[model samples]
Target: MESKQTIEAVLQGKIALVTGGTKGIGKAIVKRLEQAGATVIVTARNQPNEPDATYSFIAADLSRAEEVNKVANAIHEQFGRIDILINNMGANTFPGGGFNTLTDEHWNQALQVNLLSSVRLDKALLPKMLEQKSGVIIHISSTSGQFPIWESTMAYSVAKSALNTYSKALATEVASKGVRVVTVSPGLNKTEAMTTFLEDYAQQAHITVEEMTSKLFERVGGVPIGRMAEPEETAELVYFLVSPAASYITGANLIIDGGNFPVVK
Candidate 1:
């Protein structure tokens, strides 16, 4: 058995970059990687509510190509190379009400945030990883990529599906070069954003938050675990994937959905 200190130092001297790491799942991931002794660099549109001095922070809205380049270049200049890349930035801010409610702008924004941002960042940073012949990249996708709720998550789901495919293709291309790429499709996470969304909807519906949560479960064909996942739990999985323990795993979409996905992939 490994001592806690030894386990915590597993990633000592490693450099990790996590996007949209200011809050929620992304924030949790930053903490996890830092705890494991990795020097973590975080990028997001805004500063974290509770900032930590241990890791460096860069502010950038990754949807824009220039911003993506800036982040990549900054990391290269500061760290020279990254040992782990966690593409944890994503959102489903489009309007609900199925296809007709969505427009070209909405679709484009969805793709830009959920898919293209990672593509651009990967393109910028992957050369260093490949040149070094060692690295891990984790794409934080959503279970909606596989199980879409047409009425509400149409555009968001489409974007995540594209990300899923892209992650697999990138993994296959880079695995032989000693780099591992993996996609993590998390189910419903009890993040602050999710809580706010539920509260707003519940208020509008004149229903309790608990009732709205139950409705969400039913709409998604039920989460057998009977609850949403905590951000820390999902972060732990991301940590494991980037660690040496999961060296043989690549080109795989690992779902941490608490049994919410209806189909067996």
Candidate 2:
């Protein structure tokens, strides 16, 4: 294993931007990049409860086109160019109960947050990366994209699936120009938000939180690993993908689901 100092040296001069980086997997990714010696910039709708002086924070709801531009422009002005772009912002907050419960607004919101936000941000930032002829972009998607639970993940899945496709297409368009685009699909990370989600469902179902967790596993056809992933684990994968060690990789949709995605792709 490499020393932490050696790992940090891998990204000593890299500048990274992580969207929705104040919490959960996004927060973990920010920490990982910082540990790797990258100067990180974080953007989200709100500031974190405890702000760290290490990375610069910008407040913006990336679901909005204007907000996406604001973040892109601010990054450009401050950093000149970003070497690593992590599209880690996303949500599955729509009301459940399948298709009948989701309105046009829900579908639109899903698309904006999970798909178009990355698309617009890439359009704004890729110019500099192309000019330099080197950069990496990672789209943080979910395993639900290809294996959605209709009662809960209908719109969210649709948006992520589209995002996966967009990421692949973008990677193909830019591979010859020396920029790499990749999609990372994580399944059931044990983040704070996930804990709350399971708790809420447990309450509604009149079951223990553990039971609710098991129910979710069953719904997803079982996590063969028998547990949810830690956000840090996912972040490590992201780190590897953006580093030079993955130079030959592009246009790949890597799934980090602990063997939960069922069929081989």
Candidate 3:
């Protein structure tokens, strides 16, 4: 069996950057990477309320090119290089009434947040990884990318689908250069945002939150494990992917959906 000390220090001396790292799945990833002894840097539009946060934080709106550049420059100046990049910032805040309910603005926002932000960030930070000839880039995607809930996640899923394709292509391009790129698509996670979403959705549907939660599970083809995933559970997979343990994994889109996906890939 691996010793605790060995596992804890698996990522020692590594530098990691996790976007949208203040909450939800992003926050969990930050904690997991830090526990593995990696120096972590986080970026978000606002500072987190957590008083005991020790990770370096940079405030920047990732959707904007100028802001992305600002963050990239700051990271380069401060850390010089990054060994792990987790593109975890994403959202699905839009009207939910099928395709006609979505406007151009909504589409653009979805694309910006779910797809282009990672693209721009990768462009900005990838050079250093290429220079060093080693790095790991993980695009935190969603199961909806492949199995979109047309009425609600149309725009978000579309963007994530594009992200999935982009991740694979980027992985192929960089694999020969000693850099590894992968995508992680997680199903429903029990994060604060998810809880709030369920509450609002339940109110809108005039149903109890528990009922709404079950409906969601059914909509996703029924999780065999019978529950939503904890953010920390997803974070552990990310930790492994970014560490030396997953050295041979690249160009793969790993799904953590508790057997919800209808078919095996």
| Top TM-score hit | 3
* Cα lDDT, model 3, residue 246: 94
- Cα lDDT for residue 1, model 3? 97
lDDT of 1 by residue, 187-235 (tens): 9999988998788778878999999998898898898898899999999
lDDT of 1 at 264: 70
- For residues 68-173, write the lDDT of model 2, one tens digit per residue: 8898888888889999999999999887789999999999999999999999999999999999999999999999899988988999999999999999999999
Cα shift from native, residue 177, model 2 (Å): 0.2
Candidate 1: misplaced stretches above 4 Å?
none
Q: Please give the TM-score that candidate 1 achieves against the real structure.
A: 0.97
Clashes (N, CA, C under 3 Å) per candidate: 0, 0, 0
| Whole-model lDDT per candidate | 0.93, 0.93, 0.95
Write down the worst ten-residue block by lDDT for model 1. Answer: 46-55
Residues 1-265 of candidate 3 have per-residue lDDT tens digits of 9999998999999999999999999999999999999999999999999899989999999999999999999999998999999999999887787989999999999999999999999999999999999999999999999999996789999999999999999999999999999999999999988898889889999999999999998888899998889999999999989988899999999999998999979
Error of 3 at 117 (Å): 0.3
For model 3, the stretches where C-alpha displacement exceeds 4 angstroms are none
Q: How close is each model in CA RMSD to the real structure?
A: 1.0, 1.3, 0.9
Clashing pairs in 1: none
